[model samples]
Structures are given as structure tokens and as C-alpha cells.
Target chain A: MSGPARTPAEPATAPALEARELEVRFPAGRGRWARAVDGVSLAVRPGQVVALVGESGCGKSTLARALLGLQPVHAGQVLVDGAPLAASRAGLKAYRRRAQLVLQDPMGSLNPRMSVYESVAEGLRIHGVGDEERRVAEALGRVGLRPPERFFARYPHELSGGQRQRVVIAGALVLEPSILVADEPVSSLDASVRGEILALLLRLREELGLSLLVVTHDLGLAWNIADRIAVMYLGRIIEEGSTDEVLGEPKHPYTRALLSVVPEVGRLEPVVLTGEPPDPAAIPAGCRFHPRCPLLRSGLPDEVVTRCHGRALPVLPVQGPHRAACHATDRASADS
Target chain B: MGPGARYALRSVASGLGTLLFVVVFNFFLFRMLPGDPIGLYTRGRNVPPEQIEALRAELDRPLLEQFVTYLANPFASTINSARYNQPVWTLIGDRVWATLLLVGTAIVLASILGTWIGIRAGWRRGERFDRVSTGVTLTLYSMPEFWLGMILLITFGVGVGFVPGVFPIGGIITPGVDPTSLAGVLDVMWHMVLPVTTLMVVYLAEYALVMRASLIDELGEDYLTVARAKGLMDKVVRRRHAVPNALLPTVTLILLNLGFVVSGAITVETVFSWPGLGLLSYDALRGPDIALLQAIFLLFSIGVIVANIIADLLYAVLDPRVRA
Candidate 1:
């Protein structure tokens, strides 16, 4: 029923998408790379919702673009179904059909000049799909735009903000892609409308067995819908695990600080990190987060503090499926 | 009335108001010009005393009476043109077709070629083709039309004599060819080549530059990225999604340029010695032919008003945002 049974010997099921040491760099100066998406690796499994969470300028958006093959990668690779994606035009086009993107702003993501039907049917037309009338209608209905014919002739300006976003989602869903990389899907929406769109996404996931790679800066959004959470910091994932495991017990300093900020009555006072994150153009020599690491400021042995400045963080599995990349976490666990 | 009809009615009403304003303003504008039409026409001529008195009696009416006559029977032969010895409308009617043919062909050729190049250049921005095409169009846009026409005139008409002085240096057709014969049509087009090229290049630049800038802005919009992710072929994404939005402002520009075409390219027509409204206006100005000047102004105002109405209607059709 779950397709062919995945054998343990086959490395379990192939991830819907996986990035291995993917690096995307922009030229900062003559012969110098800005390192927008520093050597980073993450994966999305079948029928799973993985949230890549990071503040603005943390390279989360750049990483998302690279995973879609929309932007060129300076180093490393992105694989779909465990096979590396080819850079050829036809190969990329085919890959795009399997993994679609929903942008943040619905108003900006839909062409003002096109009718609702044309916007949704555009993908089908481009891919030469047959029975476009039924498919476009079905896609719109799937996004909660009921009786899609009523909306077919309407233009973008005629719709409400929520409806516009639904049209944007309908445009993506028309492709029937396996993976949807939604970049801040609800951030531009009204607070009341945001929940509806999120609910629609979850419903589509349950019905179609669609996998999603949601990128957002809101920890609350990750808590609301994500099956797995990957906390990104300065172009790398510092912590990752099941939502319950990671949120319940965040190991990395950044993750812990992030969770502390989630508003709850009688919750612990948050650990407020001082200063902005270090600039990517001039990352610190070791433990990129060490410059703002609260643990460093809490007082430690001079030798350990020196090590935080001298040694780079490594990704390490801890309990069950949870993973973190911090030298202090490693040292503490070893001591215990 | 529905809001759409009300909007269209409102637009047309405003257009008519603008034409009325132009009529009154143009009458006074020509009236304010120094020198009398008869005096300017009769300069250095030995006229009989009785003939001069007869000319003065016909021409020296008060300003208000003259304006009333102009409004009452605008196309009538009431306003005598000392230069042409006929009604002002007759003089303009003879020249209007030549100007329309020249300007219409130039407008059509330039709009098609410029918009096509712009779509390609904007789609592949920063590529070699985009940079070079943009550079070439901008250079042509900045050139003086008269100078460019003169250069072509010199090169083909006199310098190289490639056709061995065969290209008519002046007028729309050969002096002796049967006006209705095949030779007449060919000769007219042969003369058209140089002046037409000068106008096409200048006008083509405006369309190409506007389309390129607009398309570049549209390309940055998020919809295009969504289209790309929808697995659309690159060209399909551009043709179906990008070009429609970019074409909006360019369409408005084309209509506005078309309106001015009735005024003719005064300098280019002058340099080519082509018989069009522009050359006629130039000669009228030299003679201070107030009657002919007033008629030409009225024709220009009507062209502009008609074009404005068409632009408004087309914009409503193209962009639903403007429909209501």
C-alpha cells in the first residue's frame, strides 16, 4: 500500500529532496565570494512537512532557491528521489514540475493582467496537460476556492487578499507536484487569513500525500504545522528533529533562544541574545555563532572558551532523531 | 448608466472639451502672430492699386467677426489663402494624405520592430543581445531627426549617387510621371525610403526603450518566478506572462505618438522637400498664412482627441483594474 516496501538495505526511502553541502555564493568584491548559502545539507522525506526556520539575511531564502534549481549552485548538489538533478534545460524543466514554489506575497505572485482561470491553467498549458478545464477547476477547488467556475473569469484585483493567495496556491497545486517549497506563505497574509491558508495546505497534504518544505521566520508557524523543524543560523542548520523533540528540548543555543521567545503564560523568561548575527561576508574563524554565544559570556574555562574560537561546529546526532551542532553540547554530554 | 459606460462617457466628454479649448486657443495664437497674411504674401510684388484695395477689403475684418466666420463655416472657402488663392481646407486636404502615408507607415514599422526587440532584450537582461540592442536604440533615440534625414539625403542623393541621382531629391513623385501609373507609385516609394528611415529609427527607439524598461520591471515581479516554477518553458513564460503586462504602457505611448503623426515631421519633410502638412506649414509660417495655420491646428487637435478616446477605451479593455 505504501508503494514498494522500502528495504533497510536500500538506505530507507529516498528523500523527496536532499541537499548535500549545497553552497550558493554571490560575488562580494573582485574575486571574493559572499557565501550566501554556506556548505549546508538537509532533506525532506515523503509526505512530511519540514520547516527551515531562520531570520532575514540568514540565507534561508537563497537555500530554498537553490533547492528548486532556480538559481545556480557554486558547489555541492541537490538530489530528488536520491538522484542528483541534471543541469540541462529539459532536466530542470522536468524537475520543476515535480517541485513547485509558492512565494510570500499573493498579490505580487499573481499576474494582475490574467484571469483566475488563466493563472491556474498556465502550468497545465505549459506542460501540455490535457483536460485543462477539469484540472484547473480541480486545483482551485482543492485550495478551497469552491465552484471554481465563479472565479475563472475574475481578475486578480477583483479578489480579496485571501482569495488571491488561494489563486496563487491553486496555480502551484495545478502542477500536482510531490514537493511544494512555500517561502513564508502566510507572512504576507492577514492574521485571520493566515490560518485558513495554512489549514488548506495541511488538508492538501493529507489528501494528496504531498510533501512540503516550508521556509519561514515564525517559530509559531513551525509549531502549528511542521512535522520536522530545521533551525537555520547564518547559512547552516544548527539544530533539527521532530517538532515535539526539538521544541520540547532544544539543544543548540540558537534553538533554545528561539524557543524561549515563544509567548506562553508562566513560561520561562527568554534568553535574549545580544547583538546582530555576524555578517556572512566576514564569518568568524570558529563556531560562527560564538561571537554572540550566550554560553561564552556565562563564564567557562579559558581553554574551553579558546576552543569555541578555534574549533568549527560539526553536525552530530544526539538522542533518537534529534541533531545539533554546538561544541558546548558535545562537551557537556561527554562530561555527563 | 453603469460605471463602465459612465467612465467612457466621461472620457469622451473631457476629450471634446479639450478640442474646444484648442480651437479657441489656436485662433488667438495665430492672430497674435506678427504681420498680415496679405502683406506677407504680396511682399516685393508690384500689385495694381485697385487690386491691393480689393485684397485689403476682403482680409481686414475685426477679430471677433473673423472667429465667428471660422466657427460657422470652417470648411467653407470664406478664409482666402493669399499664398494658394483658395480656401485653407483645400490646401491642407491636398497635403494630408502624403503626411498620413509617411507617418502611418513609420509608426507601424517602428512599433512592431521596437516592441519585438524590447521583449527579447528584457527577457534576457544583461546578456550580449540586451546590452547591444539597448545601446543602439538609445543612440538612435538621441539623434536629431533633421540631421539624420539630411545625412541620408547627402549619402544617397548626392554623395555616392548609388542610384546615380535617380532618387528624387525633392517632392513625393517624379515631375513628369503619370500620377496614376505604376511608375508614379514606385517613384513615390523610392523618395519615401530616406525620410521614412529617418522617422522610423527615431520613433523605434522610444518604443524599444519603453518596452525594455517596463518588461525589466515586470520580470522582477513574483508572478514570473511562480511561472518558472510551474515548469513553463522560458519562452512561454515570457510570451504569455511577461509581455502582456509590459505591453500596457507601450500601447499608450504608440497611440500618443500616432496622434502627433497628423502634425507631421516638420523638419524631416522640410529637408526632403516632401509635399506634406509639415512642408505646407513651414511655407505658411514663412508667408504668415494665418488661414492655413488655423486649419492645420484644428486638424491636429481633432487627431489628438480621437487618439485620446481610443487609448482610454483600449486601456480599459486591456487592464481590468481600469475597467470600472
Candidate 2:
């Protein structure tokens, strides 16, 4: 039952979060600039969830931090609700009030001295929201802290692992923010509890019209909750499209390898990648995924090698508006 | 025994062991020196046979026999010093309180002033204020306490003629005033200035530096990041979450360091010639005061042991994480 087939709440007029040609690089010990997030451009509409999935050093957290103005970017602008994030003092303050982050490690993120009620009420007081009493009560209620009276005064140390994470989520929601950048939010949770938090986030999205940028390494999160998917590797996005397209018919070789690794509900032995992902700091020059591309066609027909290793890498379109970054995908398209 | 009582028992046993060794070693070693307490008692004067015999009986008791007697009766009828014909406990009882009040005030002032500067500099991180704090703390931390005392003496005691002389410098009270009088109390406080400041500047630097390091490290914790991400002002994020968490380790350091200063503050008193435990112990180190030396050693050991215990108990009250 679709439960009355409630239409997803309408998204806001302007994009919730947008970044143009975002590039971040650090000065190497030897005077060269090492790229972290190279030419990464993304947009998340209000009330829609977009999952950024990648291996550890794919600049996922860097991207998340820049969204919150925690990290300074070298080239490009991050706009929150149509205003530049770092334009001026007033703009920064305005951006902070609208965009919030749900951190990864719930246990480490909740201060032991803060009670559940105090932690939830903190954000409301910061943004100068409605009555402290009613808002904190409502937030705890939404997070499923049943008989909210029991947990309202309890410290973080007293709560179980799952409960601590729920309190963290409540803290973010109390501010009534427009966009929540959940940076690896559920990665540190147990398998049984991860689903509950993911569902809670999805429910909050629908009921509140909040945008979500869920940075994760799990394909399951993308499949379960994301409307769109962006797959990154070595600090660059290799694929982007609807969730079904990326999971059902992955376009790039890297995207294909990532999907092959997901463990099905009743299946055993998830597919293993042949090697660890390349270091982001020293990404391969031409087609960064060339070293591990299973479909590289080792004995390339000279023509294809000349193009792929020589200079030009092509873009190919796959199912449902999917875009893949590879010469192999282009060659495959011509062969088909 | 309950947990607290067991810990207390452990502490007491340790104190008794240390005292036993100090008393026995000082008793034999001091007697082995050139002149004996009996000789000093007579002052090379001819005394009646019965008086000499009474003094010898007191001195001839075996070191272990005398020590065991003292342990059994720390508070029991006390022995009289043959040199002064006064109760040994009575002399100790008179001096110990004055020393504690003076040194205790110095340590408290140092910790409060040090912790405040440390938190301010640490919260600001990399600013001109932070740099100034580092320079000042390191400079003052390395300056020896006695040298600082001498500098104060030259400036305030002699040059400016603020105070009359150096003999009563930073001590209990002037020789003529009765300690019960308000004037006498005021005189003691006046004397405390040089000694308190000398030790305060010397040790406050170490506290500020140690606390600064701890505060900087705690500032990187995930909870503080989460606090910042909650749309809270930077000031609130730093004051509420960062400062208290950082101060936890500094509390333990403050406790251990207080014990060091109480015992280590001798240099300041030595330079100033103040009549406190530091000056008293230095005189004992010279000669003709074996019993006094042993008594002072015993008291210093007890003060250190008590300070450590207080540090342990303070843990539960300061950090909620520890109570759990």
C-alpha cells in the first residue's frame, strides 16, 4: 500500500545547494598542487535526496566540509539557497542558518555532558526559533523517542548507540534547516540500526521538504533512499544519473565495478574489486581508472589506444539520462 | 571495606612506610655528624650528674626503639627537646599552620590566574594574543624562583625602600606584634606578597602552557565540530564545549604540580630569608636540628600524599565522563 499515494512534497523554487566548477588542491611538499576535488559540479533540489558514493579518499568529506564553509575551496563558489556561501560576513551567517550537517560518528559527536533535551534545544536557541519547550518536545517526538519524557533529561552516556544517533538527527532537525549535508551519517552505525536512521531521514525529508546530500560508501543507501546518484573516484565524478540507471545499467567501468560489489539481500559473496582504489593525491594522468579498468582491451586495436592513451576520452549516455566518463564506454557504444 | 575506605587505607599505608624510612635514616645520619644534640644541649657547659644522665638516657635509646615509640604515639605524650627543654610536637604545631596558609594561598592564586590565561590563548588559537601568551609563559616558567625572589628583594626591599628590610620578607608576622591582633594579621599578609608572587610567576607559566596544549588538542574533537555545524555562534561552540573538555587533563596536572611547589617553594623562602617551612628546612639542612629536620620531612611527605589523593577525587566532580 502506498498509503494514499501521498505526493512527495513540492521542492523549493531555487536549488537547495549548488556548486559551480568546484576545485580544491593542496600545495605539495615539492611545490606542485595536488588536486582534491577537481572540477566537481553538483546540484541538489529541495526535498530530493542525492547520494554521493565513493571510496574513502574521493574528496567526499572535503566536498561536504566546503558545503558548510568548514573548508576553504581554491577555485569556485558554493551557493546555498541562491546566495554565495563566502561572499561576506552576513552571507556566511545566513548560509549557516540554512545548511546543517549530520556527522558520521554519533558516539563521538554527542557531548557526554549534554542531555538529550539540551542537545536538541541547542540548535533552536542558536537560530532563535520558536518556544524552546515545544520545539524540543516536537523534535524528540519525530525522532521516535517514545514517551519523550523518559529520554529528555538523560545524558548521552546513558543512551544506547542507536538512541545516541537519533538524538544527533534530532539536533540537526530542530533548526528547521533547508538542506542537511549528512556526511557519512550512518557509516558508524550497526547494520540493524542503519536502516532505522535512513528511514527516519527519508520521512523527515518528505514531511519537512528538506534537501539531503548523503555522502556514503554504501550502494544500499543510494538504492534505498536516493532519487539521484553521483559516483566519484580519485576526487572526480565518473558517473551520474537516476538511482535505477546507475544500479541496473552502470555506464562507466568504475561505476560498473562499484555496483558489482553490492551484497544482495539473499545472495552471498559480494563481488570484490581486483585492487584498492588509486591514491587521490597521485591519480593516474590519463583516464585515472585505466590501471584497474577491466574492459581496457589490453590489446587495443591501435586506433582506440591512440585515442584513449593519446588525448581524448569520450562521454557516453546510458539508461535514463546516465552520463559516463570514459573512452571505453564510447568505443562500446560504437561497437554496439 | 568500601571502595573509598580501601583507597584511603592504601594511601595511609604508603605514608607510614615513607615516614619510617625518613625518621630512621635522619636519626642515625644526623647523630653521626660532628656534634650531637646532647652536646648542643649542654653547649659545652658543665652540668650536674643527674641532668647529664637524664639527657644521655634520652639520647641512648636505639634509633628503631625511638622510631617505634614515635609511631605508636604520634599524638600520645610527646618527647621534649633536651636542647630547648620544650615539647618537640609543640614547636612543630606552632610552625606548620603558618607555612600551610602562606604556601596554600600562593598555589591557589597561581592555578586560577594560569588557567584563565591558558584558556583565553587556546580559544583564540593562532592570534597575536596567543603568541604573547606563549612568550610570557615560557619566559616566566624558566626563571628560577629564588632569583626572582632576590630581584624582588633588591627592588622592593632595598632600592625603593617600600619595606624596611629582608629578614621579615614574605613571612608570618613582624617580631613585636601579637599574632592575635588584626595588625599582626595584616603584617603577615604584607610579608606574604614577595613569596607568593615569586612562586606564583614561577609556576603559573607551566600551568598555562600545559593547559594550552590540552585545550588545543580538545578543540579538534568531533563534538565541537558538530556543535559548530548546529548553526551556533563560534563563541558558544568554543566556550561551552571546548573549554570544559580541555580543562579535564589540566586538573590532574594542577594537582601534581601543587605538591611539587609546596615542597619545591624552598628556594623563594631561602632567598627572602622568610621564617616558613622552606627556610626552616634549609636551616635544618645546615646542622644542630636533626629532630626538626625529621619533623619537616615527615610533614612534606604527608602534604604530597594528601595532594595526590585530592587530585584523584577531583576527577569525578570535574568531568562527567569520568563519573560514568
Q: Give me the candidate number with maximum TM-score.
A: 1
- Once fitted onto the true fold, the runs of candidate 1 whose alpha carbons sit more than 4 angstroms away are A1-12, A86-91, A256-278, A315-320, A330-336, B1-6, B32-69, B160-167
Q: Which 10 residues in a row give candidate 2 chain A its minimum summed lDDT?
A: A1-10
Off by over 4 Å in 2: A1-13, A25-34, A86-91, A265-286, A290-320, A330-336, B1-77, B80-102, B124-132, B135-194, B259-264, B288-290, B308-313
lDDT of each: 0.84, 0.74
Write model 2 residue lDDT over A279-328, tens digit each, in one string: 75676766777777776744656665555554533333211256777766
Chain B alone: TM-score in each candidate?
0.92, 0.80
User: Best-fitting candidate, measured by DockQ?
Assistant: 1
- Considering the two chains of model 2, state its CAPRI-style docking category: medium
DockQ for every prediction shown:
0.66, 0.53
Candidate 2 accuracy as lDDT: 0.74
Estimate, for each residue in B117-206, the C-alpha lDDT of model 2 and write its tens digit.
898899887798889999999999888778888888777766554555553444557788987888988888888888788888876898
Candidate 1 local Cα displacement, residue A317, angstroms: 7.1
Clashes of each: 0, 1
lDDT string for model 1 (B1-324, tens) is 887898899889999899878878887887777767667656676768888788688667787987887677655655567678678887888899999989999999999999998988988898999999999999999999999988888877776744555456768887888868888888889989988988999999999999999999998899988888877777877888789999999999999988988899999999999899999889887777777777887888899889989999889888888985
